[model samples]
Target: MNKWQKIIGVVVILALIVANVWAVMDYIHLADTAGAWSAEITQKSFFDCIFSFRQHFWFYTFLSIIDLVIIIVLFICLWRKGGKQ
Candidate 1:
Protein backbone atom coordinates (compact mmCIF):
# COMPACT_ATOMS: atom_id res chain seq x y z
CA MET A 1 0.00 0.00 0.00
CA ASN A 2 1.06 3.57 -0.64
CA LYS A 3 1.51 6.19 2.06
CA TRP A 4 -1.98 7.64 1.71
CA GLN A 5 -3.58 4.23 1.70
CA LYS A 6 -1.69 3.27 4.86
CA ILE A 7 -2.73 6.47 6.57
CA ILE A 8 -6.37 5.96 5.63
CA GLY A 9 -6.23 2.38 6.88
CA VAL A 10 -4.84 3.51 10.23
CA VAL A 11 -7.56 6.12 10.57
CA VAL A 12 -10.26 3.61 9.75
CA ILE A 13 -8.93 1.13 12.29
CA LEU A 14 -8.72 3.80 14.95
CA ALA A 15 -12.31 4.85 14.28
CA LEU A 16 -13.50 1.28 14.56
CA ILE A 17 -11.63 0.83 17.82
CA VAL A 18 -13.16 3.97 19.24
CA ALA A 19 -16.64 2.89 18.27
CA ASN A 20 -16.24 -0.57 19.76
CA VAL A 21 -14.78 0.86 22.94
CA TRP A 22 -17.75 3.16 23.33
CA ALA A 23 -20.11 0.25 22.95
CA VAL A 24 -18.24 -1.76 25.57
CA MET A 25 -18.25 1.12 28.01
CA ASP A 26 -21.94 1.62 27.52
CA TYR A 27 -22.50 -2.06 28.21
CA ILE A 28 -20.48 -1.84 31.38
CA HIS A 29 -22.42 1.16 32.55
CA LEU A 30 -25.73 -0.53 31.86
CA ALA A 31 -24.68 -3.67 33.67
CA ASP A 32 -23.51 -1.64 36.62
CA THR A 33 -26.85 0.13 36.82
CA ALA A 34 -28.53 -3.25 36.82
CA GLY A 35 -26.47 -4.21 39.88
CA ALA A 36 -24.49 -6.99 38.23
CA TRP A 37 -21.45 -7.58 36.10
CA SER A 38 -21.95 -8.38 32.44
CA ALA A 39 -21.03 -12.02 32.80
CA GLU A 40 -23.35 -12.43 35.80
CA ILE A 41 -26.27 -10.81 34.00
CA THR A 42 -27.82 -13.82 32.37
CA GLN A 43 -31.18 -12.28 31.63
CA LYS A 44 -30.09 -11.23 28.12
CA SER A 45 -27.58 -12.36 25.55
CA PHE A 46 -24.50 -10.21 25.07
CA PHE A 47 -25.67 -8.92 21.67
CA ASP A 48 -29.11 -8.22 23.05
CA CYS A 49 -27.66 -6.24 25.91
CA ILE A 50 -25.21 -4.33 23.73
CA PHE A 51 -27.78 -3.36 21.11
CA SER A 52 -30.48 -2.55 23.62
CA PHE A 53 -30.30 1.09 22.73
CA ARG A 54 -33.20 2.96 21.06
CA GLN A 55 -33.59 0.57 18.11
CA HIS A 56 -30.25 1.38 16.44
CA PHE A 57 -29.06 -2.14 17.11
CA TRP A 58 -29.19 -3.27 13.51
CA PHE A 59 -27.26 -0.25 12.31
CA TYR A 60 -24.43 -0.74 14.77
CA THR A 61 -24.37 -4.48 14.22
CA PHE A 62 -24.06 -4.04 10.47
CA LEU A 63 -21.28 -1.51 10.83
CA SER A 64 -19.36 -3.78 13.22
CA ILE A 65 -19.60 -6.76 10.89
CA ILE A 66 -18.51 -4.67 7.94
CA ASP A 67 -15.58 -3.32 9.91
CA LEU A 68 -14.51 -6.84 10.87
CA VAL A 69 -14.70 -8.00 7.26
CA ILE A 70 -12.65 -5.06 6.06
CA ILE A 71 -9.96 -5.75 8.67
CA ILE A 72 -9.83 -9.42 7.73
CA VAL A 73 -9.53 -8.59 4.03
CA LEU A 74 -6.74 -6.11 4.72
CA PHE A 75 -4.81 -8.73 6.67
CA ILE A 76 -5.27 -11.30 3.92
CA CYS A 77 -4.08 -8.89 1.27
CA LEU A 78 -1.04 -7.97 3.33
CA TRP A 79 -0.21 -11.64 3.84
CA ARG A 80 -0.42 -12.32 0.11
CA LYS A 81 1.82 -9.34 -0.65
CA GLY A 82 4.54 -11.01 1.47
CA GLY A 83 6.59 -7.81 1.89
CA LYS A 84 7.15 -7.40 -1.85
CA GLN A 85 8.65 -4.06 -2.93
Candidate 2:
Protein backbone atom coordinates (compact mmCIF):
# COMPACT_ATOMS: atom_id res chain seq x y z
CA MET A 1 0.00 0.00 0.00
CA ASN A 2 1.00 3.59 -0.49
CA LYS A 3 2.09 5.78 2.42
CA TRP A 4 -1.33 7.39 2.93
CA GLN A 5 -3.16 4.11 2.73
CA LYS A 6 -0.89 2.58 5.33
CA ILE A 7 -1.36 5.58 7.64
CA ILE A 8 -5.12 5.50 7.27
CA GLY A 9 -5.20 1.76 7.88
CA VAL A 10 -3.14 2.10 11.05
CA VAL A 11 -5.37 4.93 12.32
CA VAL A 12 -8.53 2.91 11.74
CA ILE A 13 -7.10 -0.08 13.57
CA LEU A 14 -6.12 2.06 16.52
CA ALA A 15 -9.55 3.67 16.63
CA LEU A 16 -11.26 0.30 16.61
CA ILE A 17 -9.02 -0.98 19.37
CA VAL A 18 -9.94 2.06 21.47
CA ALA A 19 -13.65 1.61 20.75
CA ASN A 20 -13.58 -2.07 21.68
CA VAL A 21 -11.80 -1.29 24.90
CA TRP A 22 -14.41 1.32 25.75
CA ALA A 23 -17.20 -1.11 24.99
CA VAL A 24 -15.70 -3.76 27.23
CA MET A 25 -15.40 -1.24 30.02
CA ASP A 26 -19.00 -0.17 29.54
CA TYR A 27 -20.21 -3.77 29.57
CA ILE A 28 -18.26 -4.45 32.71
CA HIS A 29 -19.71 -1.37 34.35
CA LEU A 30 -23.25 -2.41 33.46
CA ALA A 31 -22.59 -5.94 34.60
CA ASP A 32 -21.29 -4.75 37.93
CA THR A 33 -24.33 -2.63 38.65
CA ALA A 34 -26.62 -4.55 41.04
CA GLY A 35 -29.90 -3.62 39.39
CA ALA A 36 -28.83 -2.44 35.96
CA TRP A 37 -30.38 -5.35 34.13
CA SER A 38 -33.53 -5.15 36.18
CA ALA A 39 -34.00 -1.43 35.97
CA GLU A 40 -37.33 -0.21 34.67
CA ILE A 41 -37.48 1.91 31.55
CA THR A 42 -39.40 5.01 32.45
CA GLN A 43 -39.95 8.34 30.84
CA LYS A 44 -37.37 10.86 31.92
CA SER A 45 -37.53 14.60 32.25
CA PHE A 46 -36.68 16.40 29.02
CA PHE A 47 -33.28 17.50 30.27
CA ASP A 48 -32.48 14.08 31.66
CA CYS A 49 -33.49 12.51 28.38
CA ILE A 50 -31.35 14.90 26.45
CA PHE A 51 -28.27 14.18 28.52
CA SER A 52 -28.70 10.46 29.09
CA PHE A 53 -27.38 8.20 26.35
CA ARG A 54 -26.96 4.45 26.12
CA GLN A 55 -23.91 2.76 24.67
CA HIS A 56 -24.23 0.47 21.65
CA PHE A 57 -22.16 -2.67 21.96
CA TRP A 58 -23.03 -4.00 18.51
CA PHE A 59 -21.72 -0.87 16.81
CA TYR A 60 -18.41 -1.24 18.58
CA THR A 61 -18.25 -4.92 17.67
CA PHE A 62 -18.88 -4.08 14.04
CA LEU A 63 -16.15 -1.45 14.05
CA SER A 64 -13.76 -3.90 15.66
CA ILE A 65 -14.51 -6.44 12.94
CA ILE A 66 -13.90 -3.88 10.23
CA ASP A 67 -10.64 -2.86 11.82
CA LEU A 68 -9.48 -6.48 11.89
CA VAL A 69 -10.38 -6.84 8.23
CA ILE A 70 -8.39 -3.71 7.31
CA ILE A 71 -5.36 -4.92 9.23
CA ILE A 72 -5.50 -8.30 7.49
CA VAL A 73 -5.86 -6.65 4.11
CA LEU A 74 -2.89 -4.35 4.69
CA PHE A 75 -0.74 -7.26 5.83
CA ILE A 76 -1.68 -9.25 2.77
CA CYS A 77 -0.95 -6.31 0.51
CA LEU A 78 2.47 -5.80 2.05
CA TRP A 79 3.29 -9.49 1.80
CA ARG A 80 2.25 -9.63 -1.85
CA LYS A 81 4.17 -6.48 -2.74
CA GLY A 82 7.36 -7.59 -1.08
CA GLY A 83 10.47 -7.71 -3.35
CA LYS A 84 8.77 -5.73 -6.09
CA GLN A 85 10.97 -3.10 -7.85
Candidate 3:
Protein backbone atom coordinates (compact mmCIF):
# COMPACT_ATOMS: atom_id res chain seq x y z
CA MET A 1 0.00 0.00 0.00
CA ASN A 2 1.03 3.59 -0.55
CA LYS A 3 2.69 5.28 2.44
CA TRP A 4 0.17 8.10 2.47
CA GLN A 5 -2.71 5.64 2.32
CA LYS A 6 -1.24 3.74 5.26
CA ILE A 7 -0.89 6.94 7.26
CA ILE A 8 -4.45 7.91 6.47
CA GLY A 9 -5.65 4.44 7.44
CA VAL A 10 -3.92 4.70 10.79
CA VAL A 11 -5.27 8.16 11.43
CA VAL A 12 -8.79 7.17 10.55
CA ILE A 13 -8.52 4.03 12.71
CA LEU A 14 -7.41 6.12 15.67
CA ALA A 15 -10.23 8.57 15.10
CA LEU A 16 -12.73 5.73 14.96
CA ILE A 17 -11.38 4.33 18.21
CA VAL A 18 -11.61 7.70 19.89
CA ALA A 19 -15.12 8.26 18.60
CA ASN A 20 -16.22 4.88 19.96
CA VAL A 21 -14.76 5.65 23.37
CA TRP A 22 -16.41 9.05 23.44
CA ALA A 23 -19.77 7.64 22.47
CA VAL A 24 -19.58 4.96 25.16
CA MET A 25 -18.64 7.51 27.80
CA ASP A 26 -21.45 9.79 26.68
CA TYR A 27 -23.91 6.95 26.81
CA ILE A 28 -22.83 6.03 30.33
CA HIS A 29 -23.16 9.62 31.46
CA LEU A 30 -26.61 9.87 29.95
CA ALA A 31 -27.64 6.61 31.58
CA ASP A 32 -26.31 7.71 34.95
CA THR A 33 -28.19 10.96 34.64
CA ALA A 34 -31.37 9.09 33.76
CA GLY A 35 -31.39 10.59 30.28
CA ALA A 36 -31.55 14.14 31.59
CA TRP A 37 -28.71 15.51 29.52
CA SER A 38 -28.79 19.27 29.20
CA ALA A 39 -26.81 21.89 27.40
CA GLU A 40 -25.93 25.21 28.93
CA ILE A 41 -27.76 28.21 27.51
CA THR A 42 -24.49 29.84 26.55
CA GLN A 43 -23.59 26.76 24.54
CA LYS A 44 -26.78 26.91 22.54
CA SER A 45 -25.70 26.43 18.93
CA PHE A 46 -26.71 24.23 16.04
CA PHE A 47 -24.55 21.34 17.23
CA ASP A 48 -24.52 21.97 20.96
CA CYS A 49 -28.20 22.52 21.52
CA ILE A 50 -29.35 19.08 20.52
CA PHE A 51 -28.85 16.71 23.43
CA SER A 52 -30.56 13.33 23.24
CA PHE A 53 -29.52 9.72 23.72
CA ARG A 54 -31.19 8.71 20.48
CA GLN A 55 -29.19 11.25 18.51
CA HIS A 56 -25.95 10.22 20.07
CA PHE A 57 -26.72 6.55 19.50
CA TRP A 58 -27.57 7.11 15.86
CA PHE A 59 -24.52 9.24 15.28
CA TYR A 60 -22.31 6.65 16.88
CA THR A 61 -23.92 3.95 14.78
CA PHE A 62 -23.31 5.90 11.61
CA LEU A 63 -19.70 6.52 12.46
CA SER A 64 -19.24 2.86 13.30
CA ILE A 65 -20.56 1.81 9.90
CA ILE A 66 -18.21 4.22 8.17
CA ASP A 67 -15.32 3.00 10.28
CA LEU A 68 -16.11 -0.61 9.44
CA VAL A 69 -16.17 0.17 5.76
CA ILE A 70 -12.78 1.86 5.99
CA ILE A 71 -11.31 -1.07 7.88
CA ILE A 72 -12.63 -3.55 5.33
CA VAL A 73 -11.19 -1.59 2.45
CA LEU A 74 -7.86 -1.29 4.16
CA PHE A 75 -7.77 -5.02 4.82
CA ILE A 76 -8.62 -5.76 1.22
CA CYS A 77 -5.80 -3.54 0.07
CA LEU A 78 -3.38 -5.22 2.41
CA TRP A 79 -4.48 -8.65 1.25
CA ARG A 80 -3.96 -7.68 -2.35
CA LYS A 81 -0.41 -6.57 -1.61
CA GLY A 82 0.43 -10.19 -0.61
CA GLY A 83 3.13 -9.00 1.82
CA LYS A 84 6.73 -7.77 1.16
CA GLN A 85 9.19 -10.22 -0.34
Winning model by lDDT:
1
Candidate order (lDDT): 1, 3, 2
* Candidate 2 lDDT, 1-85, residue by residue in tens: 5899779868876877787788788766654443344456443543244234333546666767787787788789788888575
**Candidate 3 whole-model C-alpha lDDT, 0 to 1:** 0.70
Backbone clashes for every candidate come to: 0, 0, 0
Backbone clashes in model 3, listed as residue pairs = none
Each model's lDDT: 0.72, 0.64, 0.70
TM-score, model 2 to reference: 0.50
Model 3, 18: alpha-carbon shift in Å? 1.6
RMSD of 3: 7.8
In model 2, residue pairs whose N, Cα or C atoms come closer than 3 Å (at least 3 residues apart or on different chains), thus clashing, are: none
State model 2's lDDT: 0.64
Tens-place lDDT digits, model 3, residues 31-84: 555433544334444234345446776887898788789878879977877775
- TM-score for all models, in order of appearance: 0.60, 0.50, 0.63
**Residues 1-85 of candidate 1: C-alpha lDDT, one tens digit per residue:** 6999989989988988888887778656666665456466665665465556534446468777988899789899988898775
RMSD of each: 4.9, 6.6, 7.8
